[model samples]
Target: MEVVIGLLAVLVLFFAAGYFIRKNIYREVDRLEARKIEIMNRSLADEMARVKELKMTGQAEELFEKWRQEWDEIITSQLPEVEELLFDAEDHADKYRFKKSKEVLKHIERMLDAAEQNIEQIIEEIYELVTSEERNSSEIEEVREKFKKAKKTLLAHSHTFGNAHAKLETALYEVYEALKLFESETESGNYLAAREILTKQTAVLEQLCAQIEVIPALLSDCQTVIPNQLSEIKDGYEEMASQGYFLGHIQIQSETERISGSLSLFQEKISLLETEGIHESLQEIHESIETMYDLLEKEVHAHHYVLAETLKTESALQELHAEKLISKEETDAVKLSYHLSEEETSRLRHIDKQISSLQKRYTHIQDKMANEKIAYSLLKDELIELEKQMSDVKAEHAEYREMLHALRKEELTAREQLSEARTLLSEAARLVSKSNIPGLPAVYTELLSDAKRSVSQVSEKLNELPLDMVAVNVLLEDAVSASAKVREQTEDMIEQVYYVEKIIQYGNRFRSRDENLSRELSEAEKLFRHYEYESSLKKAATAIETVEPGSFEKIGSLVEEDLEELKNK
Candidate 1:
């Protein structure tokens, strides 16, 4: 049995190894095959044939053919080796020889890598050879013609071209230098190196030409357009400053000097047309002028903003000052009514002093701004601070007013509740006087006294000057609460008396019918007469239930019937 199990285990491992190889190895082989297919589809042969038609130097074409042959040789020899190895790997996997199969797959992978590298290298060589200067000198000439066209366009607007002349002339010379280098290098059989130079020079010349072509418009914007805008910016700034707008002490002299210098410097650059990097200089100057224009616009906008806001802030401050608030009498009244703390008093004084300080500062700022002693920017923060402080003072005053209003409303409401409580207390006293029942709970009498005392306290508070309203409000609540308790107790006592009378009469119905009932009914009558209604009801009702289970319910029906008959009468 042990041997059988061991053999079965070995068989399982063998199949497992076969499964591992089949799954892993076949997938790897498929990937390698896909890579091979990609290489074949690269069309290296077709590309070589395409390059053959291009008019390249004989030596360059020979070099391309050499690499192409090398690429073909690697594919022709190594590809078959990789395919054979793949076949071997598949066979090894089929036979459950995973280790051998992995080795075969590794070999195929290496050969395929080499084959791919060879094709890529040949493709690079073919591209480089075709793009060689000897083969594409016409492209450089096309760039030269483009530069000349750009130059002619600029010269047509000669007045505007002054700023960009140096750049355009330098670029044309660079084109000449590149052409000479290309011809010299091509004659000396250095086509690739010459072509590289041509490509660089061609790109530079084209970029410079593009820069030169737009000089007419840029020159107009910089020379005519921006200077005019600068004047407007200067005028706008002065206009706002004249209108009492605080403008920060911004120096325009340096900026105006800089603009003049830049325009003059660029004009010199355009005169030195033979100078190198003139294209760069023109672009720099154009950008600088454009920057100056943008800055001028920002300054103009900033000045106007400050002007408008300063005027509004002045109006708001004047209005706030004129508004009736923050009076000593009003603040004193709040302090007296609420009995505010010492800290609150000190804070209020500090706020008043702060407002006074702010007023002085505000006047100083306005005077200085009018006299050109400060810029608009200098007073902006001060204005905001003054506005905020005034607003805070107003908020404090408003809050106090609201509190006073609410307290007054509370006083009225509390007085109304006190009146209602007095009425309830009177009604309870009258009911108790009329009922005249004995043996009541002393707690009810105490509550009645409490209600009367609470009313007295409330009335005293009301009678006082200024009313100590908070205390009065609390006393009124106490009075109302005590009155409600006394009323409930009084009403309950009266109802109990009425119930005791009803239940005693109900027990008499069985007085003659049962001797035991007679004795219990008599005992219950004594308890009822003592004002022990709850106890009396329990006693009489228990004895009565021995005769009739729902006798107490019947008694309730009789009391309701008696009350209804009395009402009808």
Candidate 2:
């Protein structure tokens, strides 16, 4: 009984699956039918009616027929084929051949797609034709209005257009011819051809209008503006030439003539309506004219500069010459007393030669100015160079003059230093002699003699002819150092002698009681007599400090005070 129930259940499931498969297949069939109906109901007829409004000849008529034939084929043949496929698909599903039903359904879908594509292509072709016709109609009217306006402008101001007038009129006629061609094509029911013709004519009209617009300005510049500028340049050139300006190198006349010839050729080009690069040519010509003007103006400015600077440069040159003469005089006078180096004398002569050459060049420049041969610009450059040279010469002269002046000042300074050194030496000798310290040691005597000899050498250098101050200063420096040393040693020796005597006298009391102290004082007295005051003082101070430490410090300060007093005396 359980096995019977399971078998019954299996039958139920099979029936149910078959029922679902049939339902799905029928649904697909219904969808295919709907798609077929959609293809049939397409407004291909309505879209074709739009094309009827256009001229139905040439490509338009042929394409319309083609679209109609294609739509008819889809409706009659392709859609029926899809319907048959859909019926086959339903029959396969009923027989429980689902795989076959699916295959038939796929075939039906492919046919519907092909029919739909054909319908879309036909509608698109019709739309393109209709849109082209409409656009061609509206564009032709706009271009025609613009063409007439351009013609009117060309006619009214034909003179301003100069040579471009006849050429522009011919171009307008060509645009009109194209318009006629468009009309001819339109009348023959070649709407697309007419559209192409109208499009080309519209472009031609636009270019013609642009040419007409810019031609007048280009002509004005070529004919009037640049020519006037060239005339001004010519007039200025002639005026400057008459006024004795050296303007031959500028070649203003030749350049202006060349530009004029170019302008004539460009005017011819404008007449032929070949104005592509003529505007740029005119602009270049204008710039060339301006450059010529600048050249002429430069010459005038240079002439003024030469005239004004001639006087100033002459004055400056004269002043420089006078300074050179003064330098020569001062150099001569100073060299008589103080020796000047050969390099110094040679530099002075060189400066004189430079000034003389400058004078000669200035004379030549003046002659050129009088003859009016060289350009003033060249003369101005020469003058600027001359002024620079003059400034250099002045600086050289001033430096040499200062050198000459320094010679006398240096002589006086050397003499003053010599006098100070002599006084210091005399004072040192006087101090030593008045000290009454038996006598100086051999080294002190030798240094004092050396100091005197140095002073004598400095004086001898000052007395020589063409006095070499360099040697004199060297001798003077030696004298100053030697004299200062003698003075310092003299003061120190005298103070030590006085302090040694005082310390010995102060130690006499201890000497009678201490045999060692008495014996050391005796040695110090013998050293003092031998003029060995430094050693004598050391021996006495050491003996005294053994009995009394730090006793010499107070004695040293007292010795300093006594030395200052002796020097003041």
TM-score of each: 0.64, 0.72
Residue-by-residue lDDT tens digits, candidate 2, 271-337: 8877787778777887888888887777788888988999998899888888888788888888888
Q: By TM-score, how accurate is candidate 2?
A: 0.72
Clashing residue pairs, candidate 2?
163-271
lDDT of 2 at 548: 76
The Cα local distance difference test for each model comes to 0.69, 0.86
Count of clashes, each model: 4, 1
Model 2 score (lDDT): 0.86
Q: Relative to the unseen true structure, what is the C-alpha lDDT of residue 246 in candidate 2, on a scale of 0 to 100?
A: 90
Model 1 ranges off by over 4 Å: 1-148, 163-167, 170-201, 217-222, 234-248, 259-362, 365-371, 433-439, 513-515, 560-569
Supply the TM-score for candidate 1: 0.64
* Pairs that collide, model 1: 167-279, 246-376, 247-375, 247-376
